[model samples]
Target: MGTGAVYLTLSNLKNHPDFLTKVEIVFFCLNIILFVTNSTILLLQLVLFRQQFVRLVLDPVKGVFVPLIVLSFATIIIGIINYLVVPGHLTFEFVYVAFWIYIAFALMVCIPMLMIWFNSSHDIKTFTPAWAFLVFPLMLVGIVAINVLRVFPLLDPRAINVLLVGYIFQGLGFFVTFFYLTLYILRVMTTGFLEGHQANGAFVACGPPGFTALALIKLGEASRVILPQFGLVSETAGEVFYATAVMGSLMLLGLALFFFVFGVIPYWFKVHKHLNEILGCWALTFPNVGFVVTFRALGDVFQSQLFWTAHAVFTYSICALFVILFSLTIFAIVRGEVLFAKEKDLWADIMPEEQKRLTDNAASFGTDTVSTLDIVHLGGRKLSVDGFSEVDLEKGERRPYANI
Candidate 1:
C-alpha cells in the first residue's frame, strides 16, 4: 500500500490532489519504526540476555504470548494480502485462504495443549493478563474468514461449513475467555491489583469480548449467508445472533473499558510516574485494536453514524498511540531499561546510565513455608536458609527476623 500510494502520487498531475499519499506515508513510517524497534530488541535479547529470553519463552504465563505473537503476525499478513495485494486477483484468494486455514487449525490444536502443559507443569504464583492471549485465536479465525469472504471467491460449497467449524472454536474461545475472566476478577478482588508491569496486563482483558463481539457480527452475517439451506431455522437466526452478540458485546466493552481505566489510571498517578520501563505496556496495543474494530462492527450492525464516528476516532487515536508507544519503547530499549543487562560490553556501551531502569515488577503475596530447609539465591550467593521470614509488607517495615 505504501509503495502503491507513492506510485499513484508521482503519476497524478494535479497540484493539490486529495490523494491517500498521507496514509501511505503513515503506514510506511509505522512499518519501519516497529520493524526496527522489534528487531533491535529481539537481537539484544538473543545476544546480551539469551538465558533470560529462554526463561521468558519457557515461562508459563509469558510463553503463551510467543505463539500468540506468531499467530498475530499471521493475521496481519492475511490482512495485508487482503487489502494490499490480492484485491485485483481473485485467483490468489486461495493462497491466503489456505494460509488462514493452516494457521487457524494450528492455533486450535496448539492452544489447548499448551494450556494443559502450562497449567500442569508450572506452579503459577501470579496470574498475569497474558492468559487472555491464549483464547484470542479462537475468535481470530472467524474474524479473518468473515472479512476475507467479502472479497475472496466463494471457492468452496463448504465455506459455510468452514465457518461452522470456526464457530465451534469461537465458542470454545468465548468459554475460555469467560472462565479466565472470573479467575482474573478473583485475582483482583482476592489478591489485589496486579502490581508493577503486570498491572498493565489488565489491558489484555479488553480483547476477548471485543474480538468476540466483532467476530459474532461477522459470523452472524456468515450464518445469514448460509443457514437458510440447512433448514435449522430461518434467515432470522443471523439477526438473533447479531442482536444478542451486540448487546453482550456492549456490556463486555464497558467492562473492558473499565478494566482499561482500572489498569492504567492508578499506575499513571500512583505507581509509575511514566510507562517507560515495562514491555507489558505493549498490552495496551492489541486489545485496543480489538475494541476499535468491534465498535466499527457495531456501526455496521445498527447502521449508526455515531458508532462509525467512534470507530474512526478510536482507529486513528489508537494508531497515534501505538506510534507514540513505539517511539517510547525504542527509547526504553536504547536506554537499556528494558534489558536486564548486568555487564559492560561493547554493544552495551551506548546505554545511558541515567536512563537505565527496571521495567517489570511482579506483584508478590505471602508464600507458605513448605520445608524448614530451603535453598535460596540472594545477591548472587547461594544460601541454605533454615527458616522463612514472615512480614506483612503492607503493614510493617520491621521484619521479625531482622534482629535474628
Candidate 2:
C-alpha cells in the first residue's frame, strides 16, 4: 500500500508542477530527519543499555529488562532496513550492511534460546518458551521461502503470503510475551505500593511500562503503515505515530504535573520533606523521554493546527496525576514509622500479663548458672612439692604427703 500510495502521488504530481516539487522536498527532508533521529536514538539505547542487553543474551528471562533489549535491537533492524533497502538505490553496500544488521539481531536472539535449550535440566522455563522455539525456525523459513520463491513465477505470491504470515506470527508472539512480563512487573509494583513497602517499590514505577509505551507507539505506527495492505486500518504509520505521541506525551506530562502539585509545592512549603520531593521529581521526569518521542511521532502523523493545544492539555492532566500519587506516596512513606510504633504500643498494652510473664522468664533464665569440672594428671612436667601446714610454715618447715 505504501508503494502504491507513493506511485499514486507521483502520477498526480506530473500535472501539478509547483506544488509537486514543494511537497516532494518537504517529504524528503522530513523523512531524512525522522529516519536519522530514530536510528540515532536506537543506537543510543543499545549502547546505553549494553549491559542489560548482554544479560538478555546470556539469560533472556531477566524480567522487564529483556523487552528493552528486544525493542532496541528490533528498532535498529527496522531502521537499517528502511535506510538501506527501501529508501535509496539498493546497492550491494546497502544490502551487505542491512544483511549484517539483521544477522546480528537474529544471533542475539537465537544464541540465547539455543543456550537455554542446551543448558536446561529439562525443567527450566522462559518468558515464552514455545514462542522462542518457534520464532527462530519460522524466521529461517520465511527468509528461505522468500529467496527461493523470488526465482519462480508461481512462487511469488506464495512467498509474499508466507513472509507476511511469518512476520505477523513472530511479532505477535514477542508482543504477547512482552505484555505478560510487563503486566507482571506492574502487578508487583502495585503490590509493593499497597503494602507500603517503598523500599521494594519501583525506582520509577515506569521503566517497563515506558518500554511498552514506546512499543505501543511503534505497533500503532506499523499498523497504520502496513494494515492498509492487508486492508485493516485507514490510518498510516504517521497517523499511528501521532496518536501514540499524543497519548503517551499526555500520560508522561500528567505524571510530572502531579509531582509538582503534590510533591514539589508541598516540599517547598515544608522544607523538611526532602525525600518526598526527590522521589516526586524522578517520577515526574523519568517517563517524559519516551513520551516526548511519542509526541514527535504524533506531530508528524497529525499535522493538525490544534496539535499544540491538545498536547498542552494532555501534558497538564498527566502531570496532575503524578502530583497526587507522589503526595500520597510521600505521606505513606513518612507515616510508616508512626503507624508501626502505634501498632506495637497497642499490642504491648493489650498483652500486659503475657509481657510480664515473658519479662520474668527472661530475668530468671539470665540469673541461673551451670558449672562442670574436669581433672587430669600431667605427664610432660613434674614438680617436687613440699607439704606445708600452718604450724610448719610458722616454724619455716615444709612437709610432703604420699598417696602410697
Candidate 3:
C-alpha cells in the first residue's frame, strides 16, 4: 500500500494543505499505516515460507513485488527521517542506512529474477505493466533514499556514489522497459488492445517514463548540489536534466492519457453493463501517482500554470480514486475474494480453444488451471494458467514442465 501511489497521495495532500492541517495529518497518519501494513504483508510472506524464503527470490513474477516491498520499507524509513524525526537527530540516521541496506539486499534478489523472467518466461502477446516492476526499484534510490542522505548533508564521494549507482540502474531499467514496451506496442499493433485482465497492462506504460523523468530530475538536483564539491563542473547539468524532465513528463502524460482513452476507457464502458473479472488492471493506481508527481515536478520547474492545473487536477483525482480502489481492494481481501488472477482470469485473451485444449489435456488434474497467457503478470502475483501446466494452487507453482 505504500507503493508510489501512497507516496503520491501523501505528496499531494501534504503539499496542498498547510502543514498540520487536518487533511495533511490524516494523510500523514495514513502513510504510516500503509507502510506498516505493507511491511507486515512482506514479513508474513517470509514467515509463511520460512527457510524457503530463498524460493521466493527465484519466483519470477511474485518476486517482482519483493523489490516493491523493500522499497516501501525504505520509503517508510526515509519518510520518518524527513518528516518525523527530530531535526539534527543522528540516532535514527542508522535506521535510514539499515533500510538502505535492506533495499540493496532486495535488489540483489529481485533484479536477477526480473532478468530471468524476461529471458526465460514464455508467452509475449499478453505483456502488460508487469514490465514496469523492474523500473521502480531503479528509481528508489534517486527518488526516495537520496533525500534521506541529504538530511545529513552527505559528502561528495558518498552522495555521488549513491547517485551514480541509481543512474546506472535507472538507465538499465529504461533499456529493458523500452525494449518490452516496443514489443508491447507492436503486439497491440498486430493483435490490438490486450484482451481481458491483461488490458490493464497498457496503463503500466504510464509509470516508468514518469518515474524516470522524476528520477533524472532528482539526480540532476543532487548533482548540482553535491557534484561541485567534488570538483565536478557542468554548468548545463541542471538545465539539461530539467528540460529533459519537462519534455519527458509531457510525453509520459500523453502516453498515459492515450492508454486511458484507448485502453481503459473502453473497458469502463463495458464494465457498467458486464462485470468482468477486473484484476491486475488495478495496477493503474500507481502510474497515475507517478503522473501526479511528474506534473507537480514539472510545474515547479517551469512555473507553468498549465502543469500546475494538471497537477492539482491529478492530485485530487488520484486521492479520490485511490480511496475508492484501495477500499474496494481491502474489502475484497477481507472477504476472501480472489485478488490474484487465476490462470483462466488472466488468460481470457488466449484463444479459448487453445486454453481448453491445454486444460482438457492435463488429465492428472488439480483444482487450479494453468494460464500461460503472457509473460508473468506485474508484481508476480498473477499465477500463470494460460499455457503452463496445471498449477496446484494449494502447492503454488509446482509445475513439472513449463510448456511455454
Residue-wise lDDT of candidate 1 within 114-184, one digit each (tens)? 65545665433477666766666665666566655555444446566566766776677777877877778
**Native-vs-model 2 lDDT?**
0.37
| Shift in Å, residue 100, candidate 2 | 8.5
> Using lDDT as the measure, what is the rank order of every candidate, best first?
3, 1, 2
Task: Kindly list the per-residue Cα lDDT of model 2 for residues 296-341, writing each as its tens digit.
Answer: 3344456643544444444444445445645765576676622133
Query: How accurate locally, in lDDT, is each candidate?
Result: 0.57, 0.37, 0.58
lDDT of 3 at 166: 63
Per-residue error (Å), model 1, residue 325? 1.0
Of 1 and 3, which scores higher on lDDT? 3
The runs of at least 3 residues in candidate 3 whose Cα sits more than 4 Å from the true structure, single-residue gaps closed, are: 2-7, 10-15, 19-66, 85-99, 115-119, 149-157, 233-262, 269-281, 339-404
Question: lDDT tens digits, residues 1-404, model 3?
Answer: 32335544555432454553455446556767777886676587566634234555656555555666555554556555645553555554564566458557657756676676667665566556665666566555555544555564556366566667767766776666777678777887777666665665567676666666667666666666665556665756645655665576567666656655666665653332212333464566665565666666677777777877777776666667767776666766766564453554434444557556554433235434444443234223233444644344323444644542
| Reference-based lDDT, residue 231, model 2 | 47
**TM-score: the better of candidates 2 and 3:** 3
